[model samples]
Target: MKHRDSKDEEKVYKINGSTSSMGNNRKKKKNMQRLGGTGLSLEAFANAKSMSNKYNPAFKKKQREFYKNAKYVSKYKQSLKQQSQQIDAFSAVRPIEDQNRTRDVDEKNIKNKNKKKPSMEELYKKKREEEEQARIEREASIQAKKVGREKAEAERKATRAKMFKKTKYGQPVMKYRIEHLLQTIQSSSRISVNNSN
Candidate 1:
């Protein structure tokens, strides 16, 4: 093998001995110098400026419109929330007003009777009586349901007893077995007569 210098190596890789890596690097340096050290060509800068000028105003306008619409939506939602809260407040006050009216009527009746105001103990006793009445009603409803269930069970047992019979060996047998057998025999006879026809 022959020893080669760097110049010979460059010549071996050059395309048709006209272009080399050094030549390419020189061309790149020239291009960079022509671009004023900004690395961007003048044509690229012009194209970018035109694109930004053409699209930026429209994009900003659309952004403003979007924000305006969002503002309106939020305001409408807040108003709706306020209205619902007002309606809730009104509804809540209505029940309290009704309760106040009943209390006022009770106070008027007591005044008309020329009686002193009931003591706290008397109020507590009245509340307790109301609770006891409610408990008694609940228990009565439960007892009625229990009695209804027992009556239904008794009725079911009676129906079952009527539909079945106990043999001497104490085995329960269907009481309608003979009726079912007669029905099947009649049906078979009818079918046979029809076939004969």
Candidate 2:
């Protein structure tokens, strides 16, 4: 005897105390069976429930109310469209009137220009007024700056005076000279007393 299939010998098979010569491939067969006959009807189930609800009087009434609300919503949308068209037409006419009004105002201004030109005195007075206002602003700004500078200078001077008083070198330098003069006066007094004695 000779073994003809080494690959077939690698798999184990047992059925009723006897091994089948072929591979035990039942899993693939069962999956194919499941694909063929699960017996589920999703569409039919949904249709059955919908039919029952459709025959119910309360459900029919609710459906009518829904349809009525939908109709009103569509009517409202149509009215909004018509109102938008009217607004667009009104806006189209408004700009032309606004332009004509502006043109009339321009013509009045041009008519006024043919009258007497502004006097040189008036022009000079206007210029002088502008210059005076500018001068006043500059003077106020300069006054504020001067006040700040003076305050800073005063603070610096006070700090400097305080630092100078705290410094060791600011002590009296003539202390030893005064002590020497005192000793000389005492010695002269002793010599004068001895001479008098």
Candidate 3:
């Protein structure tokens, strides 16, 4: 079917329960744009505020407190900046402690440089002490080695004398042939052990 007007057609074919107020409000709001703070006037805002009765006592108190806190924060920032500047100045100039330390080190170096060198008598005394100590240690080691060797030699002689005393030729004949008999016994022992292995 052809419609005489699109508006009438829409009205006739509208939903069974839909309202026209929603459509009318959407069209009206779209035609009007809010110009808020872009066109705001100080005089208009002042008049509006004077006419409004929405003031609360707590709001005034909070505004005053915020102003006081902002002032304190700005003062604190200035103090910190001043303290940092002072620190920079202090660092640029060397402190007395560092100057004293450097002076002390220089003085100590001078004192050490001017110190006396060792005398010939001192050098001779040190050399003699070192040589004496070395000689004493060598003598002790030699004495201990001599005692050990002497003990071992005594034991070997005693063993040979015992072996000779056991010989069939008797103790008297053993005196003459003891050295030769001992050498033969040692050689025979070595040969027997080797052959057995």
Best by TM-score: 3
CA-lDDT, candidates in order: 0.85, 0.77, 0.80
State how far residue 9 of model 3 sits from its true place (Å): 99
How far in Å is the alpha carbon of 54 misplaced in model 2?
A: 99
Rank list by TM-score: 3, 2, 1
Comparing 1 and 3 on TM-score, the stronger one: 3
Clashing pairs in 2: none
Model 1 TM-score?
0.28
Question: Can you give the TM-score per candidate against the true fold?
Answer: 0.28, 0.30, 0.34
Q: Which 10 residues in a row give candidate 1 its minimum summed lDDT?
A: 172-181
- Tens digits of lDDT, candidate 2, 62-101: 8899999999999999999999999888867787878799
Residues 4-56, candidate 1: write the lDDT tens digits.
99898788878466777787999989997898775558997778678966657
Q: How many residue pairs clash in each candidate?
A: 0, 0, 0
Candidate 2 global CA lDDT score: 0.77
Better of 2 and 3 by lDDT: 3
* Per-residue lDDT over 118-193 for candidate 3, one digit per residue giving the tens place of the 0 to 100 score: 9999999999999999999999999999999999999889876665564564435455466777888999999999
Task: Spell out the clash pairs found in candidate 3.
Answer: none
